[model samples]
Target chain A: MDNYPYAEQTDNELVRLSLSDPNQFLYLSKRYEDKLLRYITRISKFSRDEAEDVLQEVFIKTYYNLNGFDPDLKFSSWIYRIAHNETISAIRKKVARPTVSLDSEDLKNFTDSFDLSRDLDKSFDRKLINQALSKLDDKYHEVLVLRFLDEKDYVEIADILKKPVSTVGNLILRGKKLFKEEYNKLIINKNTK
Target chain B: MKNKNISQIVLERIKGEKIKPISRRIFYIKKVLFWTVVTLSLIIGSFIFSLILSGLFNNDWDLYDRFGFNFIMKTLPYFWLGSFLIFTILGEYYYRKTLLGHRLRYVIVIGFYMISTIIFGSIFYFVGIGDVLEKSFIDISPVYRNIILNRINFWSQPEEGLLSGIVTKIGNEEIEVKDSNGLIWSVNINGASNRNQVNLFVDEKIKITGDIIDDSLFVADEFRSW
Candidate 1:
């Protein structure tokens, strides 16, 4: 085995091994956890917390249905599929919950970190960008965020979303348009010197 | 647990306090169970198929001339599978609609039962349960195997039944029976704990109906009566 067990296996073999020896799937998690985590983190409008919860559900579900997958299919695509479903489900559950009460301190602190030039250190355009991202439809938000943040290819996003790769490409085009418009508006208003 | 806005949330929560990552025991058990299931289902499924042959075609079971003979025979694997699946689905549906519905993990947990059934079932079948069919099975003309499998795919199981039959042989986990017309039946009474003991003799008239699926035989949802 290579130092990186996941690095050596193809998605098909990983899934096959996952079926008989599920712990092998732990390799899958090691490989994709950060990537998928970032996916939900980005999709949930940089809400790493909600995204983390969503990621857990995705892994658990994947553990069980890993066999349900057809071997010919790509492993990353299948993992993304679960991520997409779990994210949508988590979002639904959240919408049903009473509004997310922002502790004034957290919001003020989060907002205070939003300065364009100074705060771009990490939470660049932090509060405002995240908030505007939250406003887009989940599908729109998810595609763009996964594309930019997760750096997944079009086929990967299509696999996650269970659409044709061409469909995903179109989604990115549309999502990017909306995202750029909203983003430009945010930067224009805040960064006008 | 932080209720702060989504940004504070990340990929950490997808993990639980305990990382029980499918222990070695479970992994081994899963392999054992899987083979055991495939083996047992093959055996059970073959027996069920013999009965089906008796029911569908009287004596000679000669399927050489049939257009779908190969298709029906190739389906030999799925009957075992369909039987297992149909039973699990029905059992859960029955339990929920009848009495034991409060199980939050009911659906996912039922899947575990399936893995166990497949491993053990395959084991039994592989261990020489139907040696007689070896000639008729392997020697099966490839043309017929595909046809038989195709035929089997079209049939499903009933949810309940008034199947009257006499018990022929009882095993550690299954019940064998002879229907009124002199056909064999393998009634898996493994999960029927709440029901009355179904003992079949040479002429014990009986009818039974429940969602019983055998991953090795066929879908039980189509098993309304037998």
Candidate 2:
């Protein structure tokens, strides 16, 4: 047991070993900490502390349900799914805080795909983008965050949201339309004021 | 609660609770059992629906003696129809809980149950299984017979229109008949133009379609023994 390098192991291997030696579970948790923290903040607009609280619960639930995890699913997707649900539950308990912080890198990556033809890299700042994002319904907002900021594909978003892939695609398209409409309206209001 | 490290907190929580993942075999076994129940419910539900349809289609709609179209509508076997709807909803619920079912859109899931019901219903009706189930349900359950199924008893009620039973006495113009409900009626065949076809013999089970003139008197229009 001393000779085995648990740190170098794959997630699946770590899961198997964690059953025998529970301490081996640490590696799996360590792998997703930063990503999950960012995910919670992005989805729920939670403060750093609130996101940490939700992250802790997510990890705890994951450990408890480890045996129930289907081996056929990717470990990353499963963990993200748990994180997604926990964040939603936490938000449901409290009135949602405004969630508007667009990562410039993410915006750059998805600008072309979203058909925001303007050179968003030069013109759009975080505050305006976040304001427009906040105007969307919760469902539309959630999908936009997952698709653009999280950079998840339709299948992964489907897995996390527990919806059909086709539904995820439809949500993104609708979200994009709403996002553009809201953003344009904001710009018009600002000019008149 | 002071822990800044996520992994350490999770490990501590698991150690405190002594939590372990459930065995994979148990999960698979439960899934299989759930699927089996869904399939059986689908089959039984479809068969019941077919029975209701069969009863409706096999009836003599033209027998409008006393109980006209309104009588037929009132006795349209809604008990089986209600049961079919209930089971279809349950089947859809169970299907949605499955792994593959979770991936399907709502329309597709609903469409699956609708298609399954039609296909299985046709098979059940074609093989006479639906009729057998309908007859057995009425024969076996008194609760069903007296409550829900009894509404269809209009088809057997002499007062409502049609009655079937044994011919206890045969006269030249009228016959004394004992209906399935064990009520006796003096059926008048003299007025029927098809009186020659209204042949009655003693101790024979027969169906007499006509109008009830009084509590004990029924005017017969048609009679058949099968």
Candidate 3:
């Protein structure tokens, strides 16, 4: 994956480049941006316009403060902090705005499996994943996002959320429980149909 | 509603847009300034510690004798440069209410530094060009190697009839030799020193020719009892 562009260099080497060569910090950006956007999008429940805008702000912050980054913490943890704050901000903005959609289709788009296969020539549809993600709470949703989508380890999740490893673990367990409960609700409805 | 399908769809939508680039110039300037301040503060702290130690302990201690100090000095400039670079590129992740995000910057910097050093060090070591590497954790200095290799030059001794007329002082694998003209030379007594080396004791005048290593010690290859 493009996630680790400088695979030969250790995270430390990349960090040096980030601090000394700001442009090099793009390694971090390229690696994290997609996953971060997904995470924010999931957390913020923003439509395309809102999520994209929030993502831009997050990146701007990441790039600007790139030098201040210490390599001691996992890169993902730092990025998550930005994403988390950005998502919160976006959510606040949505709360303030008058535009609201009651229907799930109007609130966000779903992947049209048939259309995606025909047009994008891709096998997977992201909209379905987002729905399932939305069904989970901040705790479970975020942990799942970090673990599967973002591919960050538990330690990194703990660090990103500023919780202890055990706390992060507990969140993951409870989150999974909640997600299972919610996932069953959606699936049961789909089966009835 | 399958979990796998949901994950795939979520990933795609997240990948939906290109993240906007931040203003590079403004961001980097601030980055450099911030890191410069951090490095300088660290150096200032270390310098103070060093000063305190100098005043308190052995004032006559040579500065370069410490390995940790050397490490700090070597990497200090890189820290400043790296900070400057980061300041110019990303600007601010966010200022207020985003202290966690701000702290994350340090994490990234440190992570990169560690990973890079190991990669570079390993590459340099395996490629057989480590000898030319500018910075290293491995002791690449030749003096240490040479001392361990050609280590026979530490004492003076008498062995054969050849050591005649040379007085020998012996102690701990070392011997001091004085010839008829009273010229003293210290040489090492080593069995593995070299082929045909000599050994001797006190009051035994030995005639021998010795080689000096940097005028510090001597190695005797030939000796005769006087």
Candidate 4:
């Protein structure tokens, strides 16, 4: 795999190459496979197999729409946008509620992002955080996941969601405040119980 | 599932299924089509705006005292106003379909659309397109002249002491005018004030505020060229 060429090429260059040779798309898909798979699982209720199936579709769609890719936008944002749409569509078709399935690393990233690292030391607090996130509105939950776990900038999130940048900024701000309120509510309920 | 390569699998499916990227020309055409709709909406919206201005400006504001507020209501261009609003909304919708269009907020897009319409509409009005368009519509469509331009019907009521028509003949102190309904009335202009300050000539369209002396005669108190 190390001997394979084109690993160092930028996404945009890979896209151009893939347009001429369909096999070159493998490099582009490989680059985004893990990231998009994780994104799909985090933002949806899909099992690992289902998430992988969705990721495969995302890659296929990305290749099928390669001619329509806008040069002005980053390829990463474009691919993420496709992944987000596909996951949401799959969830809708199955009539399943979207749930955030953050791994240990994602949980740590979320806590560190909000300066709640001390709370992460307790295993119970991690469950509470997960429950709180699952309880949030889909709008707030998606933005929080993109901003904190995925570590995307406001502009990138806006591009991925196809929303105005200012709107994305306001959503992130409001999402953080809502997340704190939900987390605190969960802690109080657990103590009372 | 643990060792399977998703990329290789997808690539194999693409090869087997013969899937190809949609042509770049299709996307380009779609973008161009959306922009064309946006442009047409803006232009049509501006023309409708100009027609609205023409209707308002050419309205008989001096008769407000006689006809009261109802006259103002009756003369307003509600049809053009409605059309302008429809086109404005359409312009915003199609503009959003363009690339990078969602980057701007609704307020910004609508505000820009309104400003462009006003600027262009004002230019169209000053260039006399509004008046010409209005006349053409009135000539071609009786529904427009009678219903939409209710001002004409409002003034053609001779028995109610308001009348308008084209001058067919001029006498010493009376003019024979053919009303919108094809009835000719002898308008006695002996003591009538010419508010428009224009000389009355044959085939000139005029509005008269006066009284009905008889079935065929109307004594004018005031008159103006339309």
Against the native chain B, what TM-score does each candidate's chain B reach?
Answer: 0.26, 0.78, 0.23, 0.89
Predictions ranked by TM-score, top down? 4, 2, 1, 3
Q: TM-score of model 1 relative to the true fold?
A: 0.38
Query: Which segments of model 4 are wrong by more than 4 Å?
Result: A1-4, A117-124, B1-3, B157-160, B212-217
Q: Please give the distance, in angstroms, between residue A183's alpha carbon in candidate 4 and its true position after superposition.
A: 1.1
Candidate 3: docking tier: incorrect
Error of 4 at A87 (Å): 1.7
What TM-scores does chain A show, candidate by candidate in order? Answer: 0.71, 0.86, 0.68, 0.94
Give the alpha carbon lDDT tens digit for every residue of B48-99 in model 2. 8688767676565555454577767766777777888788877877887665
Tens-digit lDDT string for candidate 3 (B1-226)? 1112222332333345433334457656765666665444443333323322222232212223533464234323333244334532332322212223333444464454444443544454455433333212114754422232111111122231122234557777667766433556676655323323344567764444445563435665555432
- Share of native C-alpha contacts between chains A and B (below 8 angstroms) recovered by candidate 1: 0.00
Q: Against the unseen true structure, what C-alpha lDDT does each candidate score?
A: 0.51, 0.75, 0.49, 0.88
Candidate 4 lDDT tens digits, B98-125? 7677777888999999999999999999
Count: clashes, candidate 2: 0
Q: lDDT by residue for model 1 over B164-209, one digit each (tens)?
A: 3455675665666554446566666555542335343444433443
- Interface RMSD score of candidate 3: 9.2
> Which 10-residue window in model 3 chain A sums to the lowest lDDT?
A98-107
TM-score of chain A of 2: 0.86
RMSD of each: 18.8, 4.2, 18.8, 2.7
- Candidate ordering by lDDT (highest first): 4, 2, 1, 3
Candidate with top lDDT is: 4
